[model samples]
Target: MTKIKICGLMTIEDIDAVNQAKPDFAGFIFAGGRHHIDLDQAIKLREHLDPRIISVGVFVDAPIEEILKAVNSGAISIVQLHGNESEEVVDYLHDKNIKVIQVFNPTDEKFNTGADYTMLDSDSGEILDWKNLLIIPDILAGSINSANVDKAIKIVKPKIIDVSRGVETNGKKDINKIRQIVNEVHNS
Candidate 1:
C-alpha cells in the first residue's frame, strides 16, 4: 500500500491536524522558506505529534551538526536533503540509524545518492512527466493533492505520496483537506 505524507508542518495546530488525520509521515521544515520552523519549535511540535506518524526533517544544504542537533532533540527521525549534499552525508546518517530522503528533479540525469528514499520535487508544484521518469521514485511529491493523488498513485506507484501546499488553506494546513487527501491516497 502507498503511504501518505503531509509536509511543511509549522505550528502546533498542524501537528494536531496530522495527528487526527494519521498520515504515515509528517514533515517539519528546517530549511528556510514559508514553512520553515526553528529547532525549538520543532521540538515542541514533535512532542504534540502522534507517535505513529514518523517525523521527517527537511533540510537544504544544512550543516551535519545542525541536522544532528535536530535528531538529538528527538524531534526528527528521518532527514530529507533538498540541497547538493554529498553521498557521505547519506551514509553517515544511515550509520546513525536515520533514514534519508534525497530530493531530485525529474530532469536530473543521475540519482545515485544511495539514500533510503528518493523524492522528486519540482519545488514550484509543477507536475512533470511521470511516465518518462527514469527512476521509480520511492516518494512522489510535486503538486500532489486530493484531485490528482489517485492518478499519481496509478502512474508513479511510489511507496509514499508527499504533500504540503496541496493540503493547505491560506498557507496553513487545513484539517478537512488533510483528511480528504489522506483518505484519497489510502483508498486509491
Candidate 2:
C-alpha cells in the first residue's frame, strides 16, 4: 500500500489529529510558510507524536547543521528537502546516516539524486504523470486529498503520498478530513 504523509502541521491540535489518524508520516515545516514551526515547537510536538507515525521535518535550503540538530534532538526522524541542495550536500547528510527525501520538479528526468528517496511536487495542484517513474517508488506531493487520493494512488503508485492544505479547513487541520483521507488511502 502507498504511504500517507500529512504535512505542515503547526499546533497541538494538529499533532493530536495525526496521532488519531495515524498516517505513516507527520510533517513539520521549518521553512517559510504560514505553517512554519520553530525548533522548540517541533521538539514539543514530536514528544507528543505517536512513535508509530514517523516525523518528517520539511526544509528548503536549510544548513546541514540545522538538519543535524533536528535529527540529533529526535525532533524529526526524516528530512524532506525542497531546495537546491547539491549531491555533495546530500552525501554529507547521508554520511550522518539520516534519511533524506529530495524534492524535484514533475518534469525532472535525471533521477540522479543520492538521497534515500525523491519526491515530485507541482507547487500547483496539478498531478504528475507518474507511470514511468514507478520504478523509483519516489514520494509524491502537491495538492492531494480524499476526493482524488484514490485516483492518485491508482495512477502514481507512489511509495509515499503527501498532503498539506488538502487536509485542512479554515487553515487548520481537520480531524475528520484527516481520518477520511487516511481511510481512503488505505482502502485504495
Residue-level lDDT of model 1, residues 1-188, one tens digit each, is: 78999999999889899998999999999999899999999999999999889999999999999999999999999999999898999999999988899999877788855899999887767986787888788999999888888988999899999999999888889999999999888877
lDDT of 1 at 187: 79
Instruction: Give candidate 2's whole-model lDDT.
Output: 0.86
Q: What's the number of clashes in each of the models?
A: 0, 0
Give stretches of model 1 more than 4 Å off.
none
Task: Provide the global lDDT of candidate 1 against the true structure.
Answer: 0.91
Tens digit of per-residue lDDT, candidate 2, span 102-180: 8887666665468898888876667656565533447878788788888878887788889998899998999999999
Worst 10-residue lDDT window for candidate 2 reads 128-137
lDDT of 1 at 137: 85
Model 1: how far residue 93 lies from native, Å = 1.0
The alpha-carbon deviation from the true structure for residue 151 of candidate 2, after best TM-score superposition, in angstroms, is 0.6
RMSD of 2: 1.8
